[model samples]
Target chain A: MRVNGAEVEAAVDPRTSLLDLLRETLGLSGTKKGCDQGACGACTVLADGERILSCLALAVQYAGREITTVEGLAGPDGPHPLQRAFIDHDGFQCGYCTPGHLCSAVGMAAEAARGVPSYVTADLTADRVVLDRDEIRERMSGNLCRCGAHNGIVAAIAATYAAGPGERA
Target chain B: MNPFGYARAADAADAVRLGSAPRAAYLGGGTNLVDLMRRNVVAPATLVDVTGLSSAIEERPDGGLLIGAAARNTAVAEHRAVRARYPLLARAILAGGSAQIRNMATVAGNILQRTRCPYFYDVAGSRCNRRHPGQGCDAIDGHNRDHAILGGSPACVATHPSDMCVALAAADAVVHLRGARGARVLPLTELHRLPGDHPEIETELEAGELITAVELPPLPPGAASGYRKVRDRAGYAFALVSVAAVLRVERGVITAVRLALGGVAPKPWRARTAEQALLGAPADPATFRAAARTELAAAVPLRHNAFKIELAERTVTAVLADLAGEAR
Candidate 1:
């Protein structure tokens, strides 16, 4: 099976979730286990370039899919633009929920490009849900921050508004 | 988690065959099932995977919508026809668990998901009738804030957590089930039972009876529906009080209405008294308040959950007001 674009073959339990594979079996500690349950977004990762809760995802279900963890976000040269914005904005304190927040923000940006509507979308029939404070707060409501870094995190995301279009749907 | 044998059911017949086996459970998205298994809450001997079945949303020629059991919550809520015909269902789904969880969670699993009582999730052998039939209930006098206010008995007080289910009950949706015997349909309102003596038996579904589809018939003209829920937290939490209301008005008078409540009952609480009060009455703010009071008059809340009565009334009024506004 391929993970994060690499081909790796090894034995794994059928019941083992993707989060277990990342933190325990494969030693990808970047993905924190805030709740183990899907309530908290601390264990989020990108599956086939779409954000998903790794804690609830079964590893066997992604036998031939691409996965991207926080550790895999940085290129050989440096961090992604969103990562840099996060640091510049001090978007993390304890940093437990940062990975999930970052992944969720990336996905949110992509969703905005695709014209998906959040609860904060003022006009229900609008082609795109405007990326505003209220919209981001509502869309990212699932991702909880223990240190109350939501303001900075939202700022970091807002700072990248001009980074051009991202993946949609 | 205990080791449980796994079996993949290729189709409906195969699933029913496996379900007939003693202590076998049907696995859909595994969002709730896996969580329960890990906590040792449920120790099924065999898991029959029913996710492989063709349970997509199918549009009936008569303009009704048939949601398959395998359809994910996200897909069902986002379906074009569901949005146009039944916005209440879509709003309820959006008000449920997070997007990632919704992506993997199926409509069938949402209805069948077990209780959210903390005592039930307690793997340290806490007293819970739902977890252990003969054991006592710690929530009777404990942290009962999230407990039910209606259709509850001394045995249990855990509230059903599905927001979508509340809307389904209000819409008069029919639950489709498949078993070794054959296919059958039960009204969504009858799918659940009061706690009474057997709190362990939550829904009317028999052992190994798999839910295949849920059908929602076309609503009457001028029919408007809305769901309102108030929780301790804003999002991703179970409701402290919730109400789903569908109203049809003609000539400024309420023609027909269906109302249901969640997070305040063992099953979705249908506000029949409220509907009866609203029938032939003018659709005004005062009339809505009177209907809400009538529905909540018989509510029996525990010490911690007494606040739910007021909350339910307020939620019901607010939902009705919104529907009335949409009609105008």
Candidate 2:
């Protein structure tokens, strides 16, 4: 599998999940394992630019796919805009779910840019999806922060979204 | 998880051949299967990965949709054609699970997903007839707050936990299946079976039969549809009760209506009696309430789930009311 712009292969058990392969084998501990189930989004990652739970994904099933984890968000110059925004907005407290929140926010921004509507999107007939506060909360509902940092996370995501596509990284 | 050999099928025929093994399962997104495997509820010796077989969602010549079985829930929900033509389907798909899960879950697997009864998931001590036939069901008497109140037998009371399937049921979609025997088409309503004497058997598909695609017919003109789900929370939670309704009214009279319910039965419950009650009647709240009551009268709730009866009625009434407003 090609992960984070690098080709890496590991001989793992067929039952091993992608999250385990990233953490235990590749030693990428940024992705935390909270529930080990798909209920929690701590293991969220980008598979072909779509956000998915790595905990429920089998490693062998992602053979030829390109995966982007939390560690892949930064550029050579500095941290990604989402990372900087999170820090600026105090988007985390315990920090266990920060990686998931950051990665999910990236995918959520792309989805919104593509005009995907959320549950709270009032007008289905509208061509453009406006990212208001309720839209941000509904779009980022997958990731859960135990420390009650939802307000900060929402603020960070809104700031990053306002930064535009050219200033993302 | 238990050790299992994995094989990625090259095609539908290859998947059928490989899935015919003694203890083999067709793997889709691995959301439900992996969770069940971790809980020791099911242990397959071989897993035939069919995710690569097909993922196309094309518009049919008849102005309908032909969705490949492997199409992910997120892709199906976000498709422009689906959102424009079948808004209820998109809404129902979005109402389920979460963004990450929808990104991974496939349409076929979502239809075939198992129930979420506490006893069925409690593989350690609870005795579930669906998991272990003739072992007796613990949910029938034990904690059954989420159990079924309709179409439930004495042996099992588990409810099918799928929001997408409920919409498909309301839309009258067709399920296409392929196997070593041959290919066949079945209506979405007949895809899943109720817990009769044989609670173990869930779907109508034979062993090794693979769901290839789901074909949805074109919606009638001037039809307005909607889906309403009342869950434990606002998002990322299973529905305690859900309603999917389609209504076409002309001159303040109901011309046609289709209603399906979730979280109330072993399969997606089609409110046929409710549809009949509303057909030709005035599109009013009184008719909707009467139809909802008529459909929910057969509910036989357990000690804890009796509230679902009222909830289902209210949800159905509310969805119909919204559709009526749209018609006006």
Candidate 3:
């Protein structure tokens, strides 16, 4: 499997979660593990461009997939647009949940762009799903911010999304 | 987590063969199984990964849907066909876990997911009858605010935790299974069993059975369906009480209705009495309330969850009223 644009391989225990393999064996400690259980979004990562909890996923099950962690969000220029947006909007208090929040917001932005509906989506027949404050909050509910920095997080995501994809770099 | 041998199955048949091994369990999304393993609630020596078997969501020849067992919760909830035809199912799926958990959870795993009873998950608690038969149920006298109110035996008071199964029961879906013996189909309502005297045996699946697909029948032409879930919080929490309702009305008269309640029973509580009371009757709040009363008459709530009786009644009435209003 590829990790952060690099092809990596290792013999891991079948019972080992993807979060464990990434943090322990691959030395990609950018992805924090708040709760080894799936309740917390601290272990959020992207597999095949979709957001999934790495703690519940077995490393062996994701053999041939492209695994992207928080470290993979940066480009040759600097931090990703969402990361920069977080800094500009002050989206973190304790900064423990920033990695998961950044990755989750990236996936949430992609989902919104694809017109995917959240639980609060009223009109299922609509071709475009509007990403208002309620939509962003509901979509990001999985990622918990114990420090209660949700307002700035939502603002950063909304701002980054409004800036279009090409303006990110 | 205890060390376990892992084997990936090639197909459904191979999955059944592998699953028949002693102390072997099927691995779906690992959302619940891995959590349980970490808590030492269950320790299977072997794991059979069945995610590669089938994951398609195809339309059946009879205008129904055949949802593969391996389909992810997020994929099923966002499926265009599911949203159009089975909105109740889509809403129920979305009402469950957060976005990340939904993306990883599978339909089959959701169907077979265990209860969220805190006592059942407590490794140190020795009073869970579901974990150890003939022992005792601590929730019966302990902190049981989230326990069941209906269809609970003295031995156990836990509730099934899947929002999707409640919708499936109201939709009259069929669960397709493949076992070492042969293929068979069971109605969604019959898939789960009441605690009765044995809370240990939750489902009717045999030793080596693997859920293949769930088939949903076509809805009536003018029928309207929806699901309503009331929980402790706005996000990522189990339901205190949930209702799934499907109704068809003509000229203000109820032609057909199907009702199911969750978080109130060990299995999805099919409100047959309520459905019977509403058929051929006027579609009004009075009638809906009466039906709810008739169905909730059988409730035997414990110490802490007695309020669920009133909550279930109001939920049922509201869901029916919404469906009836839409049908009109």
Total clashing pairs for each candidate = 0, 0, 0
CA lDDT of each prediction against the hidden true structure: 0.81, 0.90, 0.90
What value of lDDT does candidate 2 attain over all alpha carbons? 0.90
DockQ of each: 0.44, 0.76, 0.76
Interface RMSD of each: 2.1, 1.0, 1.0
Better of 1 and 2 by TM-score: 2
Q: Output the lDDT of residue B226, model 1.
A: 72
Worst 10 residues of 2 chain B by lDDT: B218-227
Q: What is the TM-score of chain A in candidate 2?
A: 0.95
Candidate 3 backbone collisions, by pair: none
Error of 1 at A82 (Å): 1.9
Tell me how candidate 3 scores on lDDT. 0.90
Model 1, B168-285: lDDT tens per residue?
A: 9988899999877788999999998888889888888877898999999987777887777688777687888888888887788888788989898888888898999998999988
DockQ score, prediction 3: 0.76
Error of 3 at A129 (Å): 0.9
Query: What's the best-to-worst order under DockQ?
Result: 3, 2, 1
Residues B206-324 of candidate 3 have per-residue lDDT tens digits of 99899999999988778999998999978888999999889999999999889999998899888899999999999999999999999999988888999999999999999999999
